[model samples]
Target: MTTKPDRFARWLPIAASLLLLAGCQAAKYRTLESFGIEKRDILGSRVEAARDAQDDAREQFSSALEQFRATVEFDGGDLEDLYDRLDREYTRSVDDAERVRDRIDSIRDVAEDLFDEWEDELDAYENANLRDRSAELLRDTRSRYGRMIVAMQRAEATMDPVLEAFEDQVLFLKHNLNARAIAALRSELDGIEDDTEALVEAMNASIAEADAFIQSLEGSS
Candidate 1:
């Protein structure tokens, strides 16, 4: 005769499944850090990600500028190849800028959650002096974050006009593949050069701010 399964045996699979689900959720929603880390640590991680994104953007813009220079300065060396290079740079730049924008969004999301949690915890403090100090720190940190984000966003904003100019040049090169095209590009070289330079300057300022923000976080810890 077949015997019925015990209750413990029947529940074992369910319990294991629940545990697995919990692990997956923990890994997915990693806003809360491990090792009992607090919101500050999460903020630090976001800062690092933001810094990395900006660095990536800086490198991409630099590379795109180089390719753009190549396109304009093409001394009749493989016209098609020059167009190909410019097209590639334009596409890569769009992708890289998207990543930068996504990273900034992530930083903003985490900052909102972290600040909310911190503000809520302010009410849990029993000591008035300590509570006041925590409140002040919260404000200070928020202000710093605001400044850093503004710098990042300013840098990000500069990319669009540069990209627009690149797109126009690329389209022009795509159609006019001759000496006249080269001459046309030469005429536009100064304008493109100025835009790229301005973009680089904006990126440099943002990069410096990112470094300062990261250093502040490190110093805090």
Candidate 2:
């Protein structure tokens, strides 16, 4: 006898292939709907994932900043080894930033599909009163979504500056691995810290917006 988990495991790849063959965002959504999953559910899940990604990114950036500070303060040690460690931190930060971006893109795609479908279905209503109520609800939901996406984008924008700063410092150290380079980094440390602080603040605001949006979505369901 096949266990339920085993059955689900076997069915997962087939469902994924079907979604792939569906060929477009809207078509994929229809395929998912056939499996009893609604757009709102997918939107909520993606929002949660994006929020988690932002959280991970925040921690990773903070860790990278600390490593940078430590490297700049080095008095005597293997500078090459220090460069390698900082380079590793830079690489991890890049990966985390990419994950956040991918999650944001996924959220945007599902959100557009959900709103478009909702708007199109309004004309199918038989009762004017019901249609009016739904229309108002749709407007309100869109307004809240607008706020959430703006916050997410603002946070996303801040990430690039921080990453560039990290990359520049890492590259400079790779070439000029000496006490002079450490002194130069120390001078630039203030600017890096400022940028990172701004990033962390933006991500926190975005994460809060995500939480509020998810709660609103669930409450209405």
Candidate 3:
């Protein structure tokens, strides 16, 4: 008997391949509609994807910050090993940031398509009251989505400076692998703390927005 994890592991690649194919096919609106996925459902899924991406990003940033903190508190060690660890963290952080950016772009793309379709459909509605109600819903959804994306973008922006700081420190340590470098990093602790805290706060806000957006969708559904 195949265990759940074993079955999942066996099908993982197949599942991934199917998802890729589906995404390619779904690029066509007709394909999406043929699959019975509505614009609102697409938006909801995209929003959730963005939220999960943001969650991953927040955790990655926090992990990187912790790594930096550990480096700053370094008493004495093999400098090369220290650089290796820091380098790994920096690379992971960069990858996570890129994923977050891509997720946000996906959300934006779906939102634009959704809103355009919605607006065009509004013009097709014959009943005046229905048209008016749909227009109002479109406006409200757009406004809420705007707030969520803005918060997500703001959090994303904070990542650049933080990543730069981490890179600079890593590069500096790579060259000057000595006690002096550790002391210098200790001096930067306050600034790094501030940046990390700000990032967490922004991420929290974005997550709250995501929760609210999801709740709104659920309520309507």
Report clash pairs, candidate 2.
none
Candidate 2 vs candidate 3: the lDDT winner is 2
lDDT of each: 0.76, 0.90, 0.81
TM-score of 2: 0.91
Q: Each candidate's root-mean-square deviation in Å?
A: 10.2, 3.7, 5.2
Per-model TM against the reference: 0.82, 0.91, 0.86
lDDT of 3 by residue, 20-56 (tens): 5665534544444544555666677677877888898
For candidate 1, write residues 100-216 as lDDT tens digits: 898888778768878887899999999999999989888988888888899889988988888898889888878888868867777777787788788788878887887887777
Sort order, lDDT high to low = 2, 3, 1
The TM-score ranking, best first, is 2, 3, 1
Q: In candidate 1, list every pair of residues with a backbone clash.
A: none
Clashes of each: 0, 0, 0
TM-score of 3: 0.86
The per-residue C-alpha lDDT of model 3 at residue 29 equals 47
Q: For model 1, state the Cα shift of residue 58 in Å.
A: 1.7
